[model samples]
Target: MTTATTDLAASRFALARQVADAVLFEGYVLYPYRASAAKNRMRWQFGVLVPPAWGPDHGEPSCQRTELVMEPRGGAEVAVELRFLHACRRTVEEARADGTFADVAALHLPDRVLVPWDEGTEERVEMSIPVAELEAGEVCLPFTRPAREETEPVPGTDGRTVGRLVRRTERVDGVVRLRADPLDLPYRALKLTAVVENTGDWTPPPEGAGREAALARSLVAAHLLLGLSAGSFLSMTDPPEWARAVVGSCTNRHTWPVLAGEDGRADVVLSSPIILEDHPRIAPESAGAMYDATEIDEILALRTAALTEEEKREARGTDARAAAVVDLADTMPPEIMERLHGAVRALREITEPGAQPVQGRDGPGLPGEEALFRPDTPWWDPEHTDPAAPHGDRVLVGGTPVGPGSRVVLRPGLRRTDAQDLFLQGRTALVEAVLRDVDGGVHLAVTVDGDPGADIRRAQGRFLYFQPDELAPLEEA
Candidate 1:
């Protein structure tokens, strides 16, 4: 019964849930916040749970089962909590003068179609059929729609069709049941979610409290699905009133207490954020947000290349406090200013153009110095094989054809490890050699144009090795 450990576990679960929530809305930073955008169409792209009915080629299934498993360490008392979106559906009917019914293809629900539970003027309720009921094959649920009619015609549809909202039901086509009673630790993990069918039909809900109903309505209309369940140990004391209230208010989040025994170990597993048509699969542990590492690296590199000189300067300034101190030092203290001047003078003297030291070689008395330094075979010599010359085989470099002496721009991306010289990105270089390594992989050796010194005697040489994608060929000079 370690309270501190249980509390820590609860906090971690809460934070993880928050991270998942952020992932859910990652694509909202677009011009139109709807899912029609090519970018936004990838719904539930992460945390996907695939059911058995759907294959890779067949695509996602409409209905599936999802489950979570929790194992408490020792004999600890544990509570489990869950949250997710519920699916609701409503039928739209067109009024006919002949008292005949015709299907309306263009009618869309602007808001959630409410259902009334009793006839005594009670508030309308949602179609919230329990999983147990669904598993029992009880498909029909009571649902009612408001007596509202579309004032304006739905865009892109025939104007002749006037539609009226009639009745609605909880969509059970996608997900049917979330089975947990059969599980060993049924109390710790269990949830039911249904697949949403019309993802493009509903609008996203606004953020903040008092919008659960709206959110639920939107999710059902969109065919978005989620489920949650919670269980607590009978021995453990009840949670605080405030905590219980918060849990009740937040439909998408839940909290539960865990009782730890002598061994003090409690493990809780939950379904992934998205459940596909297949059975729900547990998601792997993630480092905060889910994103492609390679994509991130490429983006970082591009952003760095796109930085303006002024922006680079600002970035190099470290922080405001340090920048302020340096700015103040410019006018204060004559001694400090004198030291700075001395430092600049010394730097200038050392970095002067001709200040490079020369190295002397021993025994350079070859019979013909020019002939010894020059290529033994001419460029036109058919029998000659010059390593410096481009190979007959064509190779792509950064999506462009490249050969020896081809001017190329390095695109080392944001990872310093990806580049031999971190400063080479966006800088022009020459293709000195294209060679095959021991593994038979093609490598491009390019010498950076503005590099201070030639890499003649260095082991790796002045030619930095790069993959074809890392260097873009420049246009003919």
Candidate 2:
């Protein structure tokens, strides 16, 4: 990907592909690697949308969603069988926990063999849940599995090779259905959770690898969401920073904000604390919304596309401005121009030029321009076309070109009198000193012929350093 590509989008896409691959395997939680020939493979579908802030250079944004399908192995499976058998001998509790299982069993047997398993089948069961008794927060959904691994027998082991014996049994499948919201209150927000099955047939992640992967995925999704926000929100100031701060403040109940710029382009900013507390937009006055990993990824992808487009549009303006500055500098008077050129050349020797300003030459002498003109050099016929001379972001003087990389100083108020008009004609001089700007732009410390250490300085006290665009060919338009 190009440097312009957002890091979040890249991560989201990567994880989405992994999840898609994982769900396609059979026996999702129990034996992911083992496929029951009769079971159907998992499939995913996703889409993307662009946010309002990101411009055309990025791309269109959209969302993508994937649906998971689980199929059982053949043999008319009517029940979910969770079998735990001890293949090795161990202490009472250690033997009871099977280490044969992958992630589920690994927890108990940090070093030894241990296993735990959960089986979910499409079976029906009766429950005595009262219709009216179910309050809003009364009933909670909880799913728990073994925290450690359980031990199992090796293929041909008469006894066992790894750990001790463990107890195992079958777990009946439970299906939950809601008759109605007992409180009869509408849900204030949306909630989403992911269900991942660890099939033991395949190799499990190393110890806590699974948890690490999950966390990593969440971070990636969050980033994508931010990217989506950038596409939708357009701000005059630090758009990226504002977008980040806004998203960081989002909660479970808040909706994303839409940002529009003066350019008529729009991007989305994630709801922030400022937006939630200070603004009247988005219902509930809180960010209390939850999204699944996939949902987050898709939203972020869309935002990324929008931001990319916005950036491309922005870069175009920058390039144009650089070109314009070069043009304007070319139109200055000869006397003023020489000083500007000389002073800048001196500056370049000390610091890197900010932007390249092209240089141009009028005739050797325009009418009434004798004070700044020289019959000997003939401004138009000036012989200084050596590539060795500092070309872009550099200056040419006395037949030698000076680069911005060297240190130089300007004599205050055109102190030097090579041609006193060079400074008198509203032109600045180059002297030895350090220049700094806080808001933006480049800074430099130059070396001049006179002052050993010049501290206090201003724009008028020095010559403006030029970049590549600040100078042009001696005569070429």
Candidate 3:
């Protein structure tokens, strides 16, 4: 008979809310329950709820149940690992072909497609996926296998009576709302729920006490990740008018910067392709509307009043670890930040060929613009290395460079192959010098012993770094 509403003022619930908000992002709250399942399995049932914001945009959360057997560790902690695969029913083509209709067939790929959305379109999509899939960054479907057996059944008096049946269940459901024209530029809000159960001795956390405790822990984790107050978790506390206005204005903008308004905080419309790619299990609709920052602040204050000094220390330590991985962009090294920015740029460069790369101070990059590549840095050179080396160059583009004496003049309209040749050879061609062309085809400042175009182009782009000795492979290209 107990519900989450029973102990809103309890410090445990407050802390749980903060932690959930932080780790799960705004507009989502984790709900945990103590329940018994089919057999002798110990589990905790928990989920992220999107509230009314997800109602029309997505839909009511669909309930599901899955059983997973775990190796018995202890009463306090248990390890139950689940892997999910192509779980989502819808695909990128389906979502983009018509934001309003489920036209595209389902697709299961390592990475989610970048769904484009247009302005003035309201997108609501709800789908059920495993919680493990959400954490793994792909649409993970359940495998057609039953729970694994850990320990054999207890022997009966007759050596083997009917084996005792025990079932452990784990299920996760997610919902998402992608607003605006998803075919053009889509912004999605997501929510997820994970339920675990032991058919045997399943002891639910104390209603008010348990829910409060779990929620507080989740929020603290989120806070550690965002570096923002738990109050900043909610994006809807501000007037709906503001959100609508911001969404409308940002619909056409290419890089929709996370913005702050009269709400006294910053928020980005949930249109990030990264989230969909990283959190495949989360439905686009599950991402909730902005919540009241004040609500989060108030919750923190209440939690502060309730926690013991010892509990606070323990909570802080747990939060630090969770934040390290969950807080995207906020917690990354300079090198990683650069690679992330570069990948984004590469995607943009490929999709929007005409879009000019930002330059000097005007470029859009990580906070300090430190991640942006400078035009003078020679497009042929690896962004991380010096530009002068041609023979010992480790740049892995797939084209070759002409010798220094050989004239290699490049202008607009050259074949992509020719351009790639210069790049692969680690030489500069007098390629188009337009703003967008900074990273495009270029001349190779050819040296006497540069490799051929085929060789150079073959060594252009790779995931791993190559050593100077590896440059000889370009000769075969």
Candidate 4:
């Protein structure tokens, strides 16, 4: 078995954390990008590993285990950093007059409840224990009845029966413990498990709104994503013999299917060691701060028109840094430069209100200009005009210009280390569409000629996306 030095493994761990952070806050970039947005409030939707028996009545405790294979370089010691959601089972209860508990009940009262007359009079009552309060463990809260005579209860709770004027405590006393085994390099796999449990004595919330009920009994496991550190020498192409064996048997290089058997247990297995080449180790405290900068850039792009002069100045400063990085790194790939240039241009447009829109070489705009022009729309939408060609006229395949409906062949050497490289070298494909990514990079969407997988091709509309360098135009015989 191959081994990685402690430093190399640490760097890889940092990169994994970055990828996990990206997955964690992906939806934050959508419209109404505020924490208060209703859509934004629904968190931890990605990479959720719910138990098969996870439901209101069953509420059976489940554990999510992620196994990663790593080897230290030169017999050096390595430590892995893992991050994920820590899910805890929380109960939302409403105190009833009979000392019974109802999940999220409401209270109703007259517009003007004469203290003496309405004391015992039954009225519809509704109340909610804030999620934050519940996470903090036992606490009392006052339920103030709105001065309205409404016959209806709260939207998702049971309010038909009048409940007692008792306050309900919302507390997060549950703790999810994570345990990891050291990288016994002699063995090929390292395992980590997140065990979910409830701490305090509390009954599960009664099934009400589907969403509310899920939150009530669900155990939220935090930082469930796995991060591994391996030596710099190991790469996707030149992996150790053991790592290669593990990846060779798997369908995906980066993400694998973690199925929960009837026993309600699942395992996410990763064997492809992430190669960190000359990458710096980021301090754990600064990990989130780094992501915060990227988030700010996204927010600035969305509200470019509304930025004030001071904000515009700051945006320009960021543009300057990006430009300087691009300039200093002349050998940097075109994709990197294009991304930096896009940032600069985006900021320039905001700083210079009357500036003309940047045009592509061919004409006023490149093909599929709508995607580039309207950054607010869903960039990944298939219906959007292709950013690479407006009229679907021509696309560059392997640096050679080819028109739509043309034949192309996948070129080798461009396989992504993070995802499955579906297109094999020398495989034939049909040029179906040309699209531009958010970074202003051009991508060719092609359909494989002999692929018979209906689930991937028809059901998922799975098209092999390739950079111009990854595809070559088919030549006539």
**Model 1, runs deviating above 4 Å:** 1-12, 24-31, 35-42, 56-74, 77-477
Per-residue lDDT of candidate 1, residues 13-48 (tens digit): 453444334434332222121112344333233322
**Over the stretch 23-87, how does candidate 3's per-residue lDDT look in tens digits?**
23322211110011121021112221211222223432222222111111112111112211111
Show model 2 residue runs off by greater than 4 Å: 1-217, 224-385, 388-477
**Which digits, one per residue and each the tens of the lDDT, describe model 2 over residues 360-432?**
2322222221111111221233473321222233333223343444433233222223453344232223422
**How many angstroms is residue 287 displaced in model 3 relative to the true structure, after the best TM-score fit?**
30
Error of 1 at 462 (Å): 9.0
Residue 411 alpha-carbon offset, candidate 2, angstroms: 20
Of candidate 2, the 10-residue stretch with the lowest lDDT total is 77-86
Worst 10-residue lDDT window for candidate 3 reads 218-227
CA lDDT of each prediction against the hidden true structure: 0.34, 0.24, 0.24, 0.37
Error of 4 at 158 (Å): 40
TM-score of 4: 0.36
Each candidate structure's TM-score, on Cα atoms with residue i matched to residue i, is 0.25, 0.18, 0.18, 0.36
- Candidate 3 displacement at residue 247 in angstroms: 26
- The candidate scoring highest on lDDT is 4
Model 4, 158-265: lDDT tens per residue?
445443232221232333343333443555343333333334334443553344334333333223322232222223343456666643432332223221111111
